[model samples]
Target chain A: MAVDMTQKPILVVKDLNVHYDTGKGPAKAVNDVSFSLRPGERLGLIGESGSGKTTMATALMRLTRAPGRIVSGSVELDGQDLLKLSDKDLREVRLRDIALMPQGAMSSLNPVMRLEEQMIDAIVAHVPNLKRPELDARVQQLLKQVGLEPEVARRYPHELSGGMKQRAAMAIATSLSPKVIVADEPTSALDVVVQRQVMQTLGRLQDGLGAAVVLIGHDMGLIAQFADTVGVMYAGKIVEIGPVRQMIEAPKHPYTKLLVESLPGIEVKQALVGIPGLPPPLVNLPTGCSFNPRCPFAFDRCRSETPQLQEVVPSQFAACHLYPDHKELPPLPARATRELHA
Target chain B: MSKEIVRYIATRFGQLLVVVFVAVSVNFIIPRLLPGDPVQTALARLQTSGGAANVDIQAVSAAYRARYGLDAPVWQQYINYWGDLLTLDLGVSFANFPEKVSTMIGNALPWSVTLLAVATLIAFSVGSLLGARLAWPTAGRGIKSLVPFLMVLTSIPFYLLAIILIYFFAVVLKWFPPAGGVDTTRIMRLDWATTYDILEHAFLPCMAIVLGNVGFWALGMRSQMVNVLGEDYITFAEAKGLHPRRIFVWYGMRNALLAQVTALALSLGSVVSGAVLVEVIFNYPGLGSLLYVAIRGQDYFVIQGVVLMLIVSLAVLLFIVDLLYPLLDPRIRR
Candidate 1:
């Protein structure tokens, strides 16, 4: 894929692959995934469940446990290779360079402890040099930044509504002002209204920090709303990636085309062609393209020949046989076309 | 705040009173309902010894019935029993030998409470910490490998572990004495030296109880921690670039530990009231062992009174624990 010629990337992941060694065999959840984020840029990773979206997010944090290992990869944040860093060095990088906003983590806050205590504990952990009064002021400021009532800091997690909890989570996520923040499905579980509010909060926080964000979600509409770039994943590989507008307008990969069409808000009049069949089991995936079985364009060559992501246009990239010849393909099927009202 | 606490305490205490009354009455009535008079059994032993024994069985039975008010109608007996209980006059023990029922309890109470309370606290606190440590995925492979084995060990009964400890520490190694509290000779003087001696003697038994429960507590806490660690707040703390230890210890541990504390408190109360096997194995003069022997000897009044005391104590313990819930969990408070 053609790289942006001008920008210096703040975060770069190359050949990132994660696999779980289950009792049966190894399941390749993420395979040869590569992406880069420039300073202050927002990249959205969109995929269905088991599409390696979560795996990629956690692999960034080294959060996956033993059976699930990052087989081969280099996660470079601000030019430092995170994969090669020592545990202590990684800890430093995690706190000061890159942070993660974990999904559905708000309910886990200590009910017996006040929010101020929990938030202060976070500050103390990474930035121990702060004075007590400064710490208290920072916590109060954080609560305010997250749009919470100032007194919310003194309340327990359970006392807050779900949206408030997500805000609190975002506040903490941005607390250290790390260069890159990886948020995995931050708004997936929230109500529609709360979801919009939380997303806006995240946007505002990201804007304030000017930190690169890797927003992981399956919702294309959500990605369209916030993400500057969209990376469409299928069976553990980036099937398509480009500017969000370009990808939504002229998705080159069949997988991306289907995802954009499946979005509920998109003004498609015909019956939405739901992606037939579930995502392939990471273990014992089909030969050649993992999406081949469900790919309408699949043929003899598509079955046996593996497709690598290659440049399709000036900046767009896709992994598909139809785009193999580097020629502009026909418009997507009627059902895959974008609706004006979307 | 104080009003909520008072209401919480009052409701709990009132519930405890009802439970205690029910338990004590059940202890009194169930035995009476059984065929064959307890007094007859006592007299039967005397009769076997021949007329030279000179024990009047009928008079003895009448006195026994009168003492417990069993000579009255059953309903009247119950009402009178409650009347005596309200006045804190639980009647004289039919088998106290020389002391009053209340006096025996006074002497034994301290020993039981000290042993059980210390042992439970040690087991719960240490076990919970260890469990939390092992729950961390990054802690290492060695500890992770032990989780399954610990879970298997958790299934073993507490008494089985106690017996194993007794066999190794008491009978085999002989590092600690097999049973009883302190040297009987040293128990009379409650001096520092003797107190230390008493604690030393109780150590093996206390440790035995702790070992029996530590695995279970660890397993329980580990599971709770595993779930809590996945909570969004913990993730938020981590995202905030919170130190791993702070996220885990303060946020993760504190939240997950509420369940552990509740379980521990309930277990401790039950353990205090029902230390039967441990007391029997160690020959500690706890309430369980005392009541066990009293029933076997058919010491009717002593057994009844001790059972009532145990029931009441257990009820009170539960009440206190219930009251502590709102204090521990702010969400439970208004």
Candidate 2:
């Protein structure tokens, strides 16, 4: 689905930095990240494990616990800065204006509560004066909207299949018709067919509610199928971000290139090549660009200085020194650049 | 309510029956195996007191055995034991001659039940609340410091606490009576005055029990609360913007209390046995003191009766707990 670029974004996150005090030292989990989502737009956040995608999602809602904190950031929803709001006001905004569909459907819903009870809790937390019948009707409607039968609401989370649990989570998240929903790996625990069903349900829910979505996952293929725009992360930084089609077809960042190349294709017979090195430690990141240690295209400039995310194409942005506009620096080697673009 | 639940209850009841039978049989056999004879002991006590020394010892001994039915064969005694049990005849207490075993227990049972039940309920309620508070991430250091202190208190045996309390409150302060369930010298009426005196006398032993047990409940509940707090659903609850108080009670304590309920049920089931050490220390006329007396005097009938009562009561309590389990935890229903 297409979203109008002229519309004011429903959620704007600017320079979010989250750090964890791990006793040994501070580990930067999310470093200087910024993105925006227009209403009904699906932004996929794809990264390797521990690359801060989940951390970023938690920080957006101010859900980071002690020992880990949002060091600095501005998460503005509908022009109101969430970070500046008191906990009381933030809770008012949480489900009524923004909601989260968390990871691990099996553990995300209370095992002791019925699905309807959980949904009603979310509803009544925001709309306190609603009567029981009205609340029950709302829960049933949400369950139906998520492709679940009304009777499914009566069962506890354990009784539901993995797919049903994910769908129930989606139902609760969208129950209030919040303007933005952050879904972190909603389909990670399901089989392929159920994954497709959950994704489609998520798509339908987002479209129906006209809520912007930030879908976080490690599965590139799943992200590609659903994300209107894709952001590739390495270590704790977004290395490249662009329109999904453009980024997949022509990835500019070295990390994004490796990610795109690593997608296994059933139609095309090609041995999948993995990225060469582990993501740099968050505590003691490599000297220059976070991705430089593993980048085959890294040069002396890549090791000495960090590259800012600059527009490489009309709409795509990348953080690699090999991109044009680094004055007096030699261009990337022809053989390496050729091999990447091939 | 359902066929499956009914089946589960029936199975549990059957198991309870087996346990009760085994316990009753053991109660009958163990006292018989003891080396000393109760009738002989009684006669010796009379002789030591300079009374009945001139009487014919053999003739009296034969008459006593016949009167008490100890002259029957062992197998017949066993059969008669079951027969008397079915008819609710616990024979007569050898220590308190001519007094039925049932009457002695009947008099003592209420005091123990009242003391332990009130103390346990109070301890569980207060401890669980404090434990839930301590488990909160933002709980202050002052409250968190109670964990180790409470742990030390739990490690101290109930009897030790009883001694300490007795020394300070009874011996030193002289604020309350030193021992006994109630003052028999006072008018034994169901007046507020009598009730107040009974409670006043019960204060130290009850406090000792409460202080010793509250720590365990707090520790159990705090660990469970900590575990529940770490669960993903708690995070979800927070993300849902539920009130913090609601989150603490519904999301945190509700789930944490599941394991604790089973613990509470098991502890309560053993309440009939009474806190044996504390009772012995306080000289409280509860089952624990009764058991101690019966053992020392080799009062076989009294011992058998009390043990049987404890086993039957515990089995009944457990049966009720089993019925209530699925109600408390829905997962167990299946």
The lDDT values for all models are 0.78, 0.85
Residue A144 deviation, candidate 1, in Å?
1.7
Q: Where does candidate 2 clash, by residue pair? A: none
> How would you encode candidate 1's per-residue C-alpha lDDT over B147-203 as one tens digit per residue?
777776667665676788879987899988878887777646858998777887788
Write candidate 2's Cα lDDT for A72-134 as tens digits: 989999999999999999999887888899898789888778888899998998999999999
Deviation from native of the Cα of residue A84 in model 2, angstroms: 1.6
Q: Backbone clashes per model, in order?
A: 6, 0
Q: lDDT: which candidate is best?
A: 2
| lDDT of model 1, residue B331 | 78
Candidate 2, position B191, lDDT: 95
TM-score of model 2 vs. true structure: 0.93
Predicted structure with the largest DockQ when compared to the true one:
2
Once fitted onto the true fold, the runs of candidate 2 whose alpha carbons sit more than 4 angstroms away are: A326-342, B32-75, B265-274
* Candidate 1: tens digits of C-alpha lDDT, residues A31-130: 9999889988889999988899988998987766567899998999889898898866776777467877777755646667888887777677777799
Q: Of the candidates shown, which would achieve the greatest TM-score relative to the real structure?
A: 2
Name every residue pair that clashes in candidate 1. A104-B232, A105-B231, A105-B232, A105-B233, A106-B232, A106-B233
